[model samples]
Target: MTNSKLLEQFRSFYFRNFPDDMETQINYFSIFGGLGWDVDTSKPLTQLIEELILQNFDTLNEKIEQLTLNEPNNKRLLSALAVGDRKIFSAFKRAGLNNGNGGGALNYLQEKGIVQIEYSRESEANKISKHRISHKVLFTYPFIRFWFYFIYPHIREIKEKNYNKLFKSIQNKQNSYTSLVFEELSEVLLNYNLRDAQIISSGSYWDANMEIDILTVTDKMEIYVAECKWTNHRVNKSELHKLEEKCLKLGIKPFQIILFSKRGFSNELKSMQSKDLALYSSDNFEALLKNALNSTLIKSFIN
Candidate 1:
């Protein structure tokens, strides 16, 4: 239901049914996973969208209309949140709302479990000012985000049985859009691997100046700082250095610096792996395919 544990559950369900290579599974899951539906990954996502969504337009509209109380403002806000950065201020800005009205609409959505606000916490020991650290507004499910991002934006075009705009937006934006899903699943993978660790907390870390994709701390005070590079190029020493610089500024002496990429690491970084450094490519995600391992994930990690 809620994304509190939604990413992990969708991933589990996907691997169970799709039975594809890691790359194919992740690519399709980014667009279609969060609705608890059985997706036919053989079809292109655009075809699937036409078959499942465009043909079923009135049905979806009825469903969302019920959820949003038929308010255009709420729909506008949801579309903006999905298409843009998850920053709270940016969502309101893109939706063209002042705080009072926008804040009320956000509260209503939060109450309905459609979205939630997550604040960036400053390290108590840091000297940096905390005021500029931004909060994010995230959808409760990936499918809802996908709908708003691709379908909701062009409902009028879709109404005329035209799909050109929808298809174009997806083709152009898919990689960047799916990058967020990859990052989410990367966190899920981390939590699964560290199932035995006494993890105190885990998620994205941000301050005024920088955002770190994956940061996990254990009860032993061990910190793992990671970057998920969902790109085509192999990761190198330079990526590692960037993470190091951010940690240095935050005074975070991590137990390990982890890097995950779609493409594997360079020979230089590969040789540099040690107790304090780790590199992961999508191939490493094959670990998530084990039913025995994931069945106990939330139970082990959550209170």
Candidate 2:
């Protein structure tokens, strides 16, 4: 299928099968969803999911082999990437690869569409300059991200047929693994749901000292700074204060501060919500999706 058509299919299937609950949705898709799998609803869910995961694992192995053959160090670069949700060129260098070689490998992966670059847009002054810009590398898909993060490092165990160890490792890190996906979903919500603000630039911002989960600048020069939490507990005032402190340290006076939580907010934060502060839960994400659909339909009618 064409790339656009494949993406449309992926989106339709994802939205239909995986709804608002971020953790549960990612868990379901990590096993049962992919490009070529024929999901059999009649089969036992556990049995079907196991089979789908194995099928994806086999496909991933094939891709790894191809990538390694194309570039001997590609697997190493991927291993470094799988270490976390995102990293810069220096991270790979520190992972023991030569800096020049690591950069080349990253460039190759980006060219091959295996990795994506999140170009930093932190405004130093009034004008944003292209020179001295840095970026973080991320896996382009959730399945790939999961595989690399949890499975690829344990290839030796898989080759020796020690599946139990791999399963245990994945189980231990499952929550941490899905948190990155939650952050990406938060970005989508911000893009679609921000009131009166047209996003001119948006992404995670980081430096040597700290990192902000979500940051955006609107066409009108208003800044929206946000933090995303994928925890089971409600977000509290301390977390909001931390975001406020970070923005202050960066010399940014945000027009709005957004707190996105999977489990809603604490009473203190809920009481403090106002025009300048916004709290979003999983339910708000569902509403954002509905709003997006309605907006699309209205645009179609107007066009």
Candidate 3:
């Protein structure tokens, strides 16, 4: 088969293996072409991930090492980039890099498409004005996010070909690391399904004292604010109340409030659901993807 066709088959196999989870899809693809027809599923998922990382260590390291060679301070910048929260230029300065050096590294990464720059305005009115533009750096791909989060920091051990400590570190922090991926998936669901509204902008929103997980604004000035919980337990009414409190504090009366949970919702939240409130679980995500697949736009384009 041709290269593109072979890649399509791989994507088909990957989705079949990890249909419901974005993080697992990313894990599988990061070790590209490792999964085959005789794939073993009996082992722990983390073990599988570790094995794949070890198997691809040389390839991954080659790319990273080339980057380091090009820019001597790239590894230091990668260490700073591994952080969970959004960062500005000043944050990198605090991380011990000088302003000019940090800015240059950031520009280089953006140019290379390894990182994306998100400019946040205080309000829609200020979008044209450059006074309050804030920059937030985000990874362009989940594999890069995973690498930076789990593997990049342990470059010394990786260089020594010692993976035991790295595996243990990943095991300890995998859930926390994948939570961001789950939130991004939730944002995708919101973007695809928010029926009447035209999404003008969407992303994680943060001010000095508050952070909103999934925030979207429609062209009609409607706001859809959401929280994504990637936990085993059901999300209760208290979490909804907490969202309300945050909205109140931020002076936002969202047109719709959405809650995306991994396990499901509590009995209280189930009873409280209404036109303005929405609760979604994995099944909803499945339905959303199914609908997208069967959408007229997709079908017509494919034909």
Model 3 lDDT tens row, 1-303 = 012222333344444454346334533433333233223344566666656666667776676666455575555665566664656655475457777887777778777656677665456553444444456776555555666677777777887888788788876876566666567667767876765567788888865456788889888989889998877689999999999999998788999999988788988899888879999875565533453332221110001
Give per-residue CA lDDT, model 2, range 1-303, as digits (tens): 012221332344445554445445444444333333445444543455357655456665776667555465777777677664356665576456776878888888877667778776655563344544457876655555656676678778776766777777766776666676667667777776764567688878886557998888889998888898877799999998899999888898999999988789989899999989999886665544452342211110001
Would you list the rank order by TM-score, best first?
1, 2, 3
Runs of candidate 3 exceeding 4 Å displacement: 1-43, 67-70, 123-134, 291-303
| Candidate achieving the largest TM-score | 1
Score candidate 2 by lDDT. 0.65
Candidate 2 similarity to native, TM-score: 0.80
Model 3 is weakest, by summed lDDT over 10 consecutive residues, at 294-303
TM-score of each: 0.88, 0.80, 0.79
Cα error, candidate 1, residue 274 (Å) = 2.2
TM-score of 3: 0.79
Q: In model 1, which residue pairs have backbone atoms overlapping below 3 Å?
A: none
Give the whole-model CA lDDT for all candidates, comma-separated: 0.78, 0.65, 0.64
Q: Please give the lDDT score for candidate 1.
A: 0.78
Q: Estimate, for each residue in 1-303, the C-alpha lDDT of model 1 and write its tens digit.
A: 113365565555555556466776777767666555566778877888878778888877777788889887788899888888788777888999878878888999999888887666665565365464557876766777888888898888988988898899998988888788788778878877788888878888876778899898989999988999887788899999999999998778999989988888999999999989988888787777676444432221111
108 Cα displacement, candidate 3 (Å): 0.8
